[model samples]
Target: MLVSEVMLQQTPVTRVLPIWQEWMDRWPTPAALAAEPAGEAVRAWGRLGYPRRALRLYAAAAAITADHDGVVPDSFDGLLTLPGVGTYTAAAVAAFAYGRRATVVDTNIRRVQARVISGSALPAPTLSAAEMRLAAALLPEEGAQSAKWNAAVMELGALVCTARAPKCGNCPIRSECAWLAAGQPAPSYVAKGQPWAGTDRQVRGAVMGVLRATRMPIQRELFFAPVPELGDDGLDGTTFSESLRSQLRRLHSLMAPESQLERAIEGLLQDGLAQSREGGLLLPD
Candidate 1:
């Protein structure tokens, strides 16, 4: 439950399914993962977007193995002390895993609360104090029932009361929904989309991809080399280095400007997902 909660954060269930299954298959227990190099965990993360989560999970596993005898802590406060476990994650693990009555207010749950109780299209960007209080108040006094309710409300938001194109007709609480009662209004604030094509995240993924694909460290220049422009006539099929050209072209599509690439690499290093060695880059050791 702890691993699933961590992986499900900002990541879709479809993408996480196979990876999570493989991960559990490989490391069925915290002690198993704790015994492996942290780099292996990052390598196994396999394009989940946030590679730092892998490092944090590795750290958490080690902590659990060393400090808690390989058992995930059942209490929210104790889970919060683990690396990468925040308020939502701690509450989620406590409620979902241990059947503790915790206020597990994830984005989905917050959205449901906003529309159903507050007559809003969306909740505030950050979890507000008032929202926290409301979530706590909504939780059932019984631990098991509160856990079940938490899962149900979150699933409702994800499936029926989605942020965009909500299936209000299919919503079980449509009749009593505050937003529906108030004549459903659009959100006052616009939600910004994360830039990808030309952003640092794309470049970071490219860099990590190269690192993960190769066994030895690759030179910085080759990793960030600019794509050579091809004329409208296109490449000659008779060229001797056609395969090499194709590889470079593919690499070029992934490459960002030198400065952006360097910044992205530095960020990865700071996040402990990548390492800089002698003039080359590699995954963390």
Candidate 2:
């Protein structure tokens, strides 16, 4: 439950399932993961978007092994003390894994709650105190009921009450939906999606990809190869092969700008995702 919860944060289950399964097969216990270097966890993370979560999970495993006697903490507060574990994750684990009566408000639950009770097109940009209070209040009195309600509400949001193209006709609670009652107004404010193209995140991801692809330290110069301009290379658009075009496109991404690559490498080093070795860089050990 903890692994799935951590992996599922802003990431789809389809992307997470195989990685989670492989992770479980490799390190079935806290002790097993704790015994390995943190870098192994990052390598295993394998393009999961946010790589820092891998380090946090590794740290949590080590803490669990050393402090919790190699067992996952059942209590919400105890779980929160683990690295990378937050209020949502702690509450989720308590309610789902241990059958505790937790409020358990995930993204899905928040959306469901907003449409069903608050008559809103979407949740607030951030979770508000009132929303948290409402979630707690709506939780069922009994532990088992609370757990089931959590799953049902979350599923309803993920499937039928999606952010875009909500299947209102298929929603089980459409009859009582406050959003539907209010005539399905537009969201007061749509959150801007994070940009990826040509951004530092893309450059950083590319750097991480390079590091993850090799065991040996890569020379700094390797990341600074700027893509050659087609005309400058004496190749016009019509002369370039599809395979070469693909390679150039990939090269353009790998070598963003020398400054961007430098920033990415520095950020990765500072984040402890990569280490500066003998005049080169590699994943931390």
Report every candidate's CA lDDT: 0.85, 0.85
**Model 1, range 44-103, lDDT digits (tens) per residue?**
998887888999999999999999999999999999999989999999999988999999
Predicted structure 1: lDDT: 0.85
Worst 10 residues of 1 by lDDT: 231-240
Candidate 2 versus truth, CA RMSD in Å, comes to 5.5
**Candidate 1 C-alpha error for residue 127, in Å:** 1.2
Residue 264 shift from truth in candidate 1, angstroms:
1.4
Q: Each prediction's Cα RMSD?
A: 4.8, 5.5
> What 10-residue stretch in candidate 2 is worst by lDDT?
231-240
Stretches of model 2 off by over 4 angstroms after superposition: 227-254
